[model samples]
Target: MTLNASLLKQGAACGQEGVPPPPLLLSLLDSSHHILCVSHVSPDGDAVGSLLALGSILRAQGKRPTLALQDEVTSEFQFMPGAEKIIGPAEVAHSYDLIVCLDTSSIDRIGTVYIPEIHNQIPLVVIDHHVTNTLFGTDNWVDTGCAATCQMLVRLADALGVPLSEEIAFSLLTGLVTDTLCFRTANTDTNVLQAALRLVNAGASLEFVVRNTLDSRSLGLVRLWGVGLANVQMEEGIIWATLNAESRQRSGVEPHQSDGLANFLVTVREADISATFAQRFANNGQELIECSFRAKPGFNVSQVAYSFGGGGHPPAAGCTVSGSLQEVSARVVAALRELRRQSVDGDSG
Candidate 1:
């Protein structure tokens, strides 16, 4: 089914009523000469994929696009076309016609890579699928029910009549597969499948995307998982693990190695939620902890993440707590207990 002009108008009207805008968004493209595309720190596939795909889309429309990351890109994604073009916040300065932040729900989550000086000087556009999105853009497009930002971008392309090129389709498909865990997540719907079909017709190769993304794990990552798994602990049916900077360095593990390990702890028979606490020793002597959380269906990890200054989808979300790892872990456990109590109270009430 082709998206008609009236349907597009209705979508824009509905967006004014607070619905997230369609994925194939072109409103920002009008007269914007230079655009900055960004993703959050420790970016998963969806975050990076959305930025790259959208950057490509912007480039195709004759806009100069600079894909920026608040932090470093994972080794796994370094080979993606246009990935090498990502510039640091300091290097770019106040040079963009518009700054688009993707997949990140909040500004703090951008970490040290995106300095306040840079963000304060630019017009911001936020695009995301996280339920905890704060609408922190001069223009915001957030679809909590959407499986991934890439999925939203595909719809945006369709709405704006941008024919999906092979590269754009492949990049978007990578985001969909990575964010949905190859469609294992409950967010996949008929529309999502139809979007995938369109992308395939546009020349996306599922086999190539999966091979490059899922099957590209390194031996260091495998060993890092072994260490993390060994540290797994169970508390009241919740499985948790802590990976300190020392252990990570000794294992020669990079940040990417720890990406999906926390979700794997859900394999425990009694586990309802799984969490991982990763601490980085700072040279400046401030404590910072990265907390990754994942819950089984029916759990709202987004709420859990928000309580501690983070956000994402219900089943998958995370936050970084500014304290010692032990302190953050304790707070997370307490929050989970409170969440369970609230659940029980709601059920009984």
Candidate 2:
């Protein structure tokens, strides 16, 4: 169980000298025979991509690896190589030699797949790239400076001596591309581009991954966007939209289909922060508001999300709050405005 103290990128000095040494990450994988790999619920591309790529890497070592996700993979990501192999919570095994959590920030992010009462006894390794990571695993490899966890895995494969195969290359490249929004994110550094290039050289099609991920969207999502944008609100540099049950029903879209709205709203030139509030119903039939937030480079929404029991990077974050869509949206928008005010004040000072 080792924790990397800093970033781990190929060709750059990681400067990570933590207790138990960094090589133990590989040792954990090598010593384990049967492994369980899981990612966050409502997995984005990075989550699904990292899960599949890790399975391929483990299989290369002749180890049996099972990939599990709390929810089903979206239609757009179903085309990813080996995506059909991903299992749901019910299909997960009772035991495994080791558990690898990828692209997940905390234990709860793995959702119902991890029953802490029994599974806590087993060794756990967390591989993620988020500033808000709780470092819940026995072995935590959190590289906040890295753009995506998939980029860190590129260096991990090099250390483990696993040559990038076509399947692995496709999966890893998709994670890199989607997380960085096809290299349009603020964190798209030289290291990120070089990693994408290496993956492309290893037989991944950049254009193909882009077309399937960033360039594609469902018609339902477009309809939902139309509903959200019709009543978009802005105040003190914070712009936001609320999607209640009526809005969703009117647009004929589900909750998951409303994801890209926040990303779209944040593009407004006058808005430094943007948010999308979607209404949801819990299993117990209680109302829950799912809040997705985005920020410009100088504004951070992660801490605000963390304050509300959610986690993500500085530019993008989210949370699930219990309240009506209007209540939650108003509260979160006020918080975002304050955050922007403080950020601007600090910069001026």
Candidate 3:
């Protein structure tokens, strides 16, 4: 179960065929005895999956890995293996030989799970698939072409000479299915499917993953969507909705449940871009808006997200802004319209 870093330098399948992890990434894994693995705040399946999968992989390497997240795993993804064991920032130890950030675009994206003064003192490794990644880790292996960070970890397991345990396969496949919307995303290429296939062959159940994640939601979310969709607005091929704190309380929905309302808006036939602005309170309890966005295959939302100090893929991205829900939604919708205008004009040009 103990693998050598030299194998990574030899260019093994650890990173898939085209996306190899840097040897230093593997060296840290080979060298570090205790590791901390974390994903983003308000984690989606990809974030939680990558975090859990890394913990499983590190354990296989005979290393102690602490899995941490800034937010609780939503009900939809709690079915995934090991989701219950993930820790919060307060539970994290003050010392570790290494920290591996997974599926997070930037250091802050991991929330307080990464204490800059403490965990930052350790050698950090970043493994992510988001183009907006800041390369914050001391050793970074960012594969933007990989559909999900879980997909990248598959390659990492191979490179590390570890077999895919059922726990690993189940965790990774959850990310692939949710991030790609059951193989329907624009980024779902043959390689992604092939990785999924291998995971299934290794004993992960595709039906189980799909049923629990993509096909399931809490009734609270359904109620929140009702409130969100009722306020939907459209302008110049842009669609948006606002879920203010009042509406959220009336609907009895958690902030995370109110998300994906943006993704739901883009399904409108007349819409080319979509956004949902949901209200949230920071650790200091100041109200802010969390903007989630989605665009059709040919359009790009990442640019807009990056412009707002956030980052994600072209078809999906987001940012956090400070203002009333109404104010933030209005400002963001204006930007979405401009992005749509340019995307349309560029297509015709």
Candidate 4:
């Protein structure tokens, strides 16, 4: 059976059973020339997992795969497969025949400080699960309802008739577990659970992946969390925290060390919405703030983030704001306020 035929059958069964089946993206992969896979800046679990897993598949098919990143992978992502193979933006000179951007919603969010010599302005293949995606790719596979890009990749693998190896299954599982918050997110559907089961059956050790990704943290990261939690400010049911460069240095933490800080704010009982702003003061005298946004069901944080040049899913999304921490924080706070006010007024009407 063809890949599309297999996926269509699975999708039909899922629909009949009222399950949200993952979409297949492998059809686009078979035609890709030189593949460039990228993720968002300051990579997270899903970002790392999606890129590596997909890159592995491309290599399996004998395609020349280059995993490009805006910068080097942080210590956190060092354990993922293909981490060492990532080429920084400065080293990217060959025009990609096909660029597969994973996890990132927009081209700018791919976070490459330097542009590549993309030949023929090659077609982009965007595979993402973020609702905020702008459909920037020439060929796009976006299933906003799916839990993670890796979940989507699993379905793609099945379509391609490729058996999942332990390495591939682990990478895909890591993305699903982290993005779903260990299956805590609202979008965690029955099909997603089945995908997890399939990964486990294929040799993915869920317990190990979970323990390492979430349970392991450095002392610096723990201290940085305290800094984030301490600075947590709540206003009109919105909670936010700002971690500036000075605070990061003082806490002996790097930018990505505060990775889960925004989600931490979401646990606050009084907050319907939460965000964490990480400010990096570069030695070159330039500053940029990374904004991470999270919200409960009724709030549309993705739309709010997209307004400021960032995008993600409705429940979790982020954008990078340029300027000092203070400047960006004020702008973000104001945007959230406006969102809340608009929501409130909509309810009244």
Candidate 5:
């Protein structure tokens, strides 16, 4: 069933009160038959949740949907009902009626899974919640005001007249909880809570999702954080840390285990901005530093990340730089300091 304008507007405004969905988004979905859905590389909770939720919703509507991701679904999220259905790039077909890209800011974020040469003929739909989104789709529904892409999908489900099933509700709620840190982020509003409440009422276990996502972490991850904290630094209201490959090895954790260190560093009482620089090797064996940034309320780190060719929300963002950890850290820390300086000066002005 096609969503009327009123329903589209209501669904789009699910989180932001009066905002509306793109005029053509609902129509695009209505017209499509087979769809291929993909999220970003290094799939996070929001990415996986939105991808699986949308896939489930489409299946309920009698459409064939293929869910693809460039990275593996980390063990933390594998318990979700449809996690096993996700396929890698090697498994993707060359044809689809449409391509729905979820939670990704730019086309490149899909990695090699999206082949422009093969998939270019398909209508590309971009659904995301990143403030730094590049608007790189034939049809784009980017709602930066929404806390997570899954929040946007909650609206989409409403538009499609699909009631949230138990699986869909659980997946969507996982995204909302992890992205908002259980409604503790600054962007958490009545609408976010309302969406979450709906999911809870639909049988999503808030306690279960919390226990699996935010409240749970491996001992190795805790050790990684300890190593990261040992080298932490703070200057001009900015806190920073570095996690080298050796530190990852010493902690007996994978590279992504250091992901939460920046978030932890941002909790420092005196700091408004936090950053983590991690040493990694590229496919070509070249050394690189992955930079993750997080800002407290009223500060935006997305622009800084955008300047380095990465994208994200105001409160959290990231970019990868090709350089030694020390060099990249020094350079990025200076840039973050400048960003903090500008924001502080602008606030006082």
Candidate 6:
């Protein structure tokens, strides 16, 4: 069924209340034919979930949509419906009526999937929840208040008059569950719970999502965590760990598998801030460090990340820097120390 403009307006008023639908987005979708959809590199739950759910929504609306990602979906997220259908940058065509960039803060976050030579002429639409979004799209729909981009898609689905199918509900719920760490994040407000409730009511299983995502971990990942913990260091209320290439190879865990280390470190009673520095290689074959940071409530980490040319929320953020393991870890740790000091001083002031 085509979107009923009056019904959409009423639904936005009564269902979403203060969060009205973007009329321009609606108009764009209505006019578009074939579309290209993409998310960030190193696809996370929110990235994969939002891309697949949006693809399903567009297909339900009878529009041909192509889903693309710069990185392969990790094994953990492969269970998500439509995960197998996602194409890589090599397969993306040079033409599309429109491009939908989801859950990414900047154009570079989309990685190689976005080729300026081929896609510069196409109108870009960015849908994201990051406070650090660069607004590098012809139309940007960024809602930092939303816990996840999938939540925004829930509202978009309502505006498009597309009923939430089982697949769409599952995809959306996966993003909500993982990004919020099963609703444990500080940002898990009433709106987040309400959005999750609607997805559950539509046929997504909370238990299933938790079991597959937050609860599931590989033996190698457990070993990797152990390695990280073994090298843990703390000073001045900031705790951190390093995962070098040798440690990672010995542990036999994929790079993405170590994501939760920083989150785990922040749980220490003595730490108000936490960081994890993992050695990685960039596209140019140069050594770089991927730094992930987490802050306890009332402490902001995004500013530090932004200073280092990265971006995220107040509670969590990250950046990539060029350097050896020791060099990067020392530099980032010093930065985190200053950030913690500033936070304490602000509280005192």
lDDT of each: 0.75, 0.84, 0.84, 0.77, 0.86, 0.86
Give all candidate RMSDs, comma-separated.
Answer: 5.0, 3.4, 4.1, 5.0, 3.7, 4.9
> So what's the TM-score on candidate 1?
0.89
Candidate 3 residue-wise lDDT, 7-64, digit = tens: 4333223234456888778888999988888889989999988888889888988999
Give the lowest summed-lDDT range of ten residues in model 3. 7-16
Candidate with more favorable, higher TM-score: 1 or 2: 2
**Taking the tens digit of each residue's C-alpha lDDT, what string does model 5 give over 16-56?**
54255576777878888789999998888999999999999
Q: What is the Cα-based TM-score of model 3?
A: 0.93
> What is the alpha-carbon lDDT for the whole of candidate 4?
0.77
* Native RMSD of candidate 3 (Å): 4.1
Quote each prediction's TM-score. 0.89, 0.93, 0.93, 0.87, 0.94, 0.93
Over 258-336, each residue of candidate 6 has an lDDT whose tens digit, in order, gives 7799889999999999999888776698998888999999888988888888888889888888899899889888988
* TM accuracy, model 4: 0.87
lDDT of 3 at 108: 83
- The predicted structure with the larger lDDT, 1 or 3, is 3
Q: For residues 45-164, could you state the per-residue lDDT of candidate 1 as single tens digits?
A: 888888889888877777888887866677787767777878775766566777778888887776665566655666676677777876656666766667888988987676656789
Which runs in model 4 stand beyond 4 Å of their true positions?
Answer: 1-28, 113-117, 344-349
